[model samples]
Target chain A: MSNKVHRRRFLSQTAAVAAVWTAAAKTPCRALAANDSWGDLTGRLVYDGAAPERERLVVDKDVDCCGKFDIRDESLMVGADGGLMNVYVYLRSKVRAIPPELQKTVEKQVLLDNRDCIFIPHCMKIWNSRQEFYIKNSDPVAQNVAFSPDLDQPANIVIPVDTDATWKFNRPQRKPVPIACNYHPWESAYIFPVDHPYVAITGEDGTFTIRGLPLGELEFQFWHERTDFLETRDWPRGRLTVAIRAGLNDLGTIKLPPVLFAKK
Target chain B: MVFFSAALVVSGCGQSESPGFRINLDGYDPAKVSQAQREAIGEAMEEFFGTPDVPRVPQELGLDAERIAVAAGPVEGRADGAQHGVYRQHCAVCHGISGDGAGALATTVDPYPRDFRLGVFKYTTTRAGAKPLRSDLRRILLRGIPSTGMPSYAQLTDRELAALVEYVVYLSIRGETERYLVQRVIDEGEYLPLGADVKEEVFDEAAVWAAESWAAPEQNPEDTVVVPPPRPEYTPPQRAASIERGKQLYASKNSQCVQCHGPKGDGDGENDLLYDDWNKPKIGVTPEETARLARLYRLPAQKLRARNFREGAFRGGGNPEDLYLRVYAGIKGTPMPAAGPQAGAGGVLTPEEIWDVVNYVLSLSGRY
Candidate 1:
């Protein structure tokens, strides 16, 4: 049989499973309510190995505006005590439930600013189910903002200096889409879209907290943007499949192994 | 002669299989694909994508899915994911099995094979800014792309053509869905060898997203021909004047025609090293890093080449209106800029000016 036929047959088989998943999610089980039992989950992701060297980007053009400050590469960033920073951790659960306190905090407009040719938060999240971007260009020169999203209209807009633009995704992206400036090739950042409230981006201390997670065998995904590519799609580096109860659960200070970043 | 040497230099360091898209189906990597994954992906494709003619899903979801069905006989595969159905035999040499425009003979072909996942079909009869009609796809399949490695399939029966078309649609949808899932894996916690518990759920979510995309108005528009405004009958002198006007317009700053398409429209323009939107935005990678990526991706440098308009190998279509639309919308996903007013404030060409340029381009290619 031709490869096309084989692929079709194969796709047909996979489509069946996909149909079931869609069919199930469409008519969601509303039984799990807000007040119906929530739990807290906290953890720290640290790299046991020495941190990678931070490369400085040379501002090729616009030296007057860009040459003001030294720019360190945000791409393979590591924090104090070998603590990994800017790592996005999200919980994958069908039941999207979070305490009211955390709900307000998570559902805020995500801001990504181009200050001195650097994206303010090198990494950010649309932690809430509702994800949007209020991108601003602080540089004197124009920053042509463009993003890679699979759905709807393409994200390409020129945000003039001191001005901002707003964009929203119809659905959560499969990965954090990279935002880039055409004018400044060196300026780039990633925005992760998440549907649930249990997602947290690790801070300088490499510590993270998802105040209210749907209790049970809470599943978590840990990802750092600069890690080596993996054979499997999920858990590019770290995965948390642990049981958490009604109270606090600290899966503390786990090592970010070198094998994950090992060159193939 | 200069262009020939340039081509040589581009592919000189490349291995025998340098322009990856050149070789036939023999080049497919049997290892990257797994049977279970293929079956799962295939099944998902069927449910979400369905045959183009009869989509298993709802109208709003998969209204315009490609349903070309070819009877290439029953193809089989080992536990590994590599399996060639109709695609590898006929199309994979030019378009990769993954449909990423990185086939074995890819580099040799000017204006690389279409990356289907971009969802931008060059040829179409539908309204401007809409997906091509099924007949458009069928026509391309049977007729074959002109002036390129793509060969005519006059020998293949219409049924075979249909199957090939259907498989291309299948690959397009499949590639798009895979990209979606990879993005999901980044956003969500799910990993490969999907957990038994969430496999169905994850597939369901992704399928829904995939179906919605396939069923989008842009992808499956049921529109009539977007005919251009009719041109006034011109006298011999008037025609001469229009062509003269067109010659100047082609070289205008806004047109930037001479920079890439060349003075004679032979595609040997001054700025030949242009990258498409996809490659242009790729940033911060060292040369070594880029090489590693290109190897994994099976793509050449993929610098955009100005079309040798003299060849009359318009990937969109050779019709006058097709040429008109090419100038109007400027072929989305390509470096070709939209010159018509529809391009908003940046648009530099008026309706009449656009037609003039169209006539001039046709004259150069001898298609006028």
Candidate 2:
């Protein structure tokens, strides 16, 4: 074939493929619309019985101790027994019935201010479809804003003095993005972006409450940034599964296991 | 032809014999140039000199022109001349036309430009009560400060430097004079009369005026100044109660301390993840990410957590009042939130709550 004719044919074939992909992508949203009822999924994150764990492990060895390393009074552990906090518990499968009023409230823009060289809320959760958020720097100094997502493209933005900036993520991902300010080396924050709005950050007492859950029996997934990932079949590191019902339900205590050490 | 030749010979002999020299001169007379061309040339000359007026002594114009005379001398004059141009081009943008350093730029530069009006320069070699020497100003001009937008004018010549120094001093004198006049006006409501021959007697008249002013109907001593009463010290029980209340509020649901700061009060909160504004991994987090996390949450590092109370560096403060102050005042340049009601210009917490928060934080250090 002549070069011009070949180019024309290639262009036509590429356009046809793109049209087919766009049509296929819209099908999932339509399917999700049919089952739009909200459901409750409750479970406790527990550490499986295993070998003794190391407490307050210093993964980064370069930090010099101003004094002797002390772990006894440290608040590393959460719950009454000091377990990990911020263990996200949510349904593994998709369930769609969200109330119209609840949806509106959920859609409100979440504000994260970088004041005095620290993120106001250390941990935040937003629905997957939520695209934009306000990040402000109230500090007199400049701060670097970096986000590392497990599945999507990461972004690094520089927040100038006394200025506010915004970041938007179009795709949905289940993992939390670790954030840190480069100018203020010690400043850090976390952002959990997911398709569902069933996530909650654990409070100071190492407790999290997710209210307004719909009535149903559902399997939930628990994930913490500090602990290892857990699967449905194998409830690893700090994972759990439970059946949630209508009304208020408290998932018993969740314990975070200590870090595993290999014998030399 | 015979007579003409004879005459030429006679003239030549006369010129040679008399020892007179004569030369032919031929060229354009610049004086006859067109008026437009002359004006254009004059403008070009002004542009070259960087100023319209020829340099002159300040004393000739009834100004304290000592500095100007000194600046025009060979050693300092050249430097001052170069600096004068720089001052006009850059410093005058803010320092003002008078060199009082109260230029238009003063309104924009934070901590405002130095008011040379006082002739008191900070960041100088001179000690307190001493005036900065010429070299001190020169050094500042050469090396610009970091973190500020001031740029160094190291390219100026020595003459320019000297001229600038003199001009600055001239501005200072004028500014001080202006201030003195204003002060005199404020004190007496007008310029006080000074008799040509009066000395000690002038003070007697002034004292009388002062007494009359003090007793005047419009004057009230209390209106000039007001002082607040001192705060009473808290009793032991009061202190204990405040600390207890503070601790309760800290662990409450609203504060949410445990999430990032671990339960034991260490900095290892469960959400201690190293992320950036974009939710990406921060650059080079391999070495000190965890320590950074602890610092962010205001948690004492593991090593510091076990230290004796005396050995630990108390960042917020040791005593309840000190802690309260920290919570109330919020560290000026840190992320530690001000727990006090009036921490920032418009803080959210109430004064009582700020005290409670301070008491609670101090309790964490085992100070109760």
Candidate 3:
């Protein structure tokens, strides 16, 4: 259509839209910004076949500190009945606009304690941008916490013995990022920064519940620490596109086969 | 009753203002063009590109520029020159207004943002010596380089990213034209005046060159990327001896790796203040220009950090062949010099020696 014709049509429609908007704006439109009523997404991502055996690590570098404890590699964690831990299940919805309501729900601080030369949480999930991390070094020896995000500049801060520092991630990560201690190469953890609040990390029991997700056809992706989300995503056990309704949406017992994962 | 009545009477209303464009002679001085030639150039540009507030080329060419304007308009302080706010927020801080890779935070960054004026992009899927594919740009926009300050704008809506990509192409073309004009003026040895015919020809040729870089790929098959030969897997004995040899080579003055990567492979080399290809200092720059460039870059001279091997986040993948390719090709646009056979006489390391160095570097991170 010509610009003149398009403008004319637009003007006429504008008046009607304005009147409708004025009427709609009388009631609170805040809820429209984000989901007011939220449902829960619950699931247990477990190993499909026989669980992979834990491999012994060669703690050749820091023998004095690292040798005190026999550390098994935490790359793959499996429990009774093939329960999996350290698996990140988060909403893959393209809606990046953080709901103001959800924004208010961010925790003041998530603790990451370094005790016995290991990051407390092997896999961590930051809900929203509002939250910051408090890294505490419980070990007597000084430890460095180095984060290498593919999207942002890498940061390595040395925390003196028994001291703590506060850090917050400015950028959101699409793929899971690894946090390694240069001094202790064996100490590795993963950080999955999601834009939305509906992200959860599996516990030792290998179960997770993502809370307060908006009602819609929400897509979720599963990621493990070693899983390269950039290359292939078959290990995510196929995508989950579900029409979210009120109350609970149980994905129930998802399986991750050992073959697809090339554990480092 | 209200909902039904509203539905019955109304369709979507009001005009969302279409996006606009303004073409500037990127990285070129206006003093070279004569008054008449300048006027003619301006008129031609006006015909080709519309005012910043209202782009006319898309309308004339039946292109849809508005539909592709950023979905979330100009978040994170990025904009395109004065008119394009989205580019400034995300890209212009590193890639300057003229796409020169010299912006407020340009020099502070390692492997500086690409100077689109040269029309060279390092990471691309379209083989060697070809303009990067739009998909390649999109991938970088979405994924972002991990080790750099470039963060992923994956959250950006599809339309927003597509619009940004188009703006980049526009800037590259503009920069290329500016370069072409400057070269022409230099060749002619003329002062303050170029004939209108020359100006027109130069502008037209530049546009064709820049435009063809994008268009020709559609018809012609992409040049196949050269794949490196397979690396030999080292046995325990070979691995130890090779690593020892690599250590000796690294310490040698000829290797030059020690100069930048340091004795411990900690990245604190003696010559830490080196420039990458993108930020390679050039002559013919006036003191005023240098000051202006510095202000634009907002940094003290920063250099690319030699990869601290112990803390391994290899930018070009971490596989065996990936490391070999890196050692062979060296990282383009960075201070890291390539040591491959194809790197010419300067490439002192033999293929086996390069492998040995790669083995040692990998062993530092325990990857080997």
What are the RMSD figures for all models against the true structure?
11.9, 28.5, 23.9
Select the stronger candidate by TM-score from 2 and 3. Answer: 3
lDDT of 1 at A238: 41
Per candidate, the number of residue pairs that clash is 53, 53, 17
Q: DockQ of all candidates, in order?
A: 0.07, 0.01, 0.01
Can you write out model 1's per-residue Cα lDDT over B259-352, one digit (the tens) per residue? Answer: 5688889998755555665455331267766555555444555676778988887876777787887776565554464455431123456789
TM-score of each: 0.61, 0.32, 0.41
True contacts kept of 1: 0.01
Q: Model 1, A1-264: lDDT tens per residue?
A: 122323222122122211111011112122223453655566677767888877788676456677777888787667868877877777755555556666665545888888987788888777535656777767775455556565544544545455566666556654567876544667778887766666677888788877676667755666667652221232333444556555566666677666665432
Model 3 TM-score is: 0.41
lDDT (0 to 1) per candidate: 0.58, 0.42, 0.58
Writing each residue's lDDT as its tens digit, candidate 3 over A20-71 gives 1001111223233333465567778777777777887756544566678777
